[model samples]
Target: MDDSGLVSFFRVESCGLYRIRQKADGEFISDGFPEISKSLFDWLSDRSVLNTIPWDPKEHTRRDKVYCKDVHFDSYTGDYLFVLWFANSEAAGEVGEVGEVGGIDLNSKVGDTNNDSEKIDAKNSTGKELTIGKAMYYWFIPSLKLVASINFKHSKTDIEAFTTYIKKWFDNKNKHPNKT
Candidate 1:
């Protein structure tokens, strides 16, 4: 193999999203550092929490009627490693809108619990200071939740840690199908 060894960190949070941090030192792109706590709203966008919408604005044009943001973010393992750097782009546009729209906000109430959440390591590696490759982020449908993400080996990304995480939003959508 032209490259040495490849590593990946999977941080799955309650926000319904999973983070896959890819690491390959020499062939890496972004710096290797754990993604700590990004803001709620921004995190959603950065995490591509809107692309999961199964409905198309041009057709249903729904997902446009909410103001979302995580109140808390925590992985099963809780790997609160130091954040190196992170950057994300959109294949369509923002998180929500019409065929041309972009952005995702469903009025969340996750609150400030994320700060106190446990900070677990990347399980295998220290996830301290390393190099990251490509940063991949995706979202779910209907609830417009975060599903899965993958970072490729590049020159700017930090893939030292893969802390699996899920988004726990406090929105109507988050409510069970059969509410009291």
Candidate 2:
């Protein structure tokens, strides 16, 4: 659906109209438009970005509409690029826009059910302070980037697990050996 569920269509500046429909896996497909062969559909369907959002359908919404920062199709390479991020409802409110990154208020008294000071590692190998509360997932054709953060109040292990699940689908769209 076109963000509203009234109809489904994707239009590109160069490419003409495309009729899209959700597949059984909650991924979308262009129903044989522009006379692309069946093989192309298989390829496109296999690379769906939705596979990276690691929430269980039973626990979360069906995800007909995902929280996305940006989405676009590269005309030069014929690859689709998109960024999906999660800021928890309260964190989203802090940043104003869902697209903003890293305005997580560590001191905010929200979603802070677990406050274990012992688990604080100070920083990860990358030198960035290990944080909790906000997470982001990005997919660009064959590359998938996932970062899960934890604040002082959230469980580092649990957020790590969620990020791991998101990483599991990184190769969902690879045409060759998928990048790790």
lDDT of each: 0.27, 0.30
Off by over 4 Å in 1: 1-26, 36-42, 45-180
TM-scores, each model vs. reference:
0.18, 0.26
lDDT of 1 by residue, 63-154 (tens): 22122222223454332222212212332332222243212222212232221112222343433322221222322221222233333332
True-vs-predicted CA distance for residue 74, candidate 1, Å: 7.4
Question: By summed lDDT, which 10 consecutive residues of candidate 1 come out lowest?
Answer: 101-110
TM-score of predicted structure 1:
0.18
* Candidate 2, 36-133: lDDT as tens digits: 21222233332333233434444655332222233345556444433333434344234323343242223322222321111222242333322323
lDDT top scorer: 2
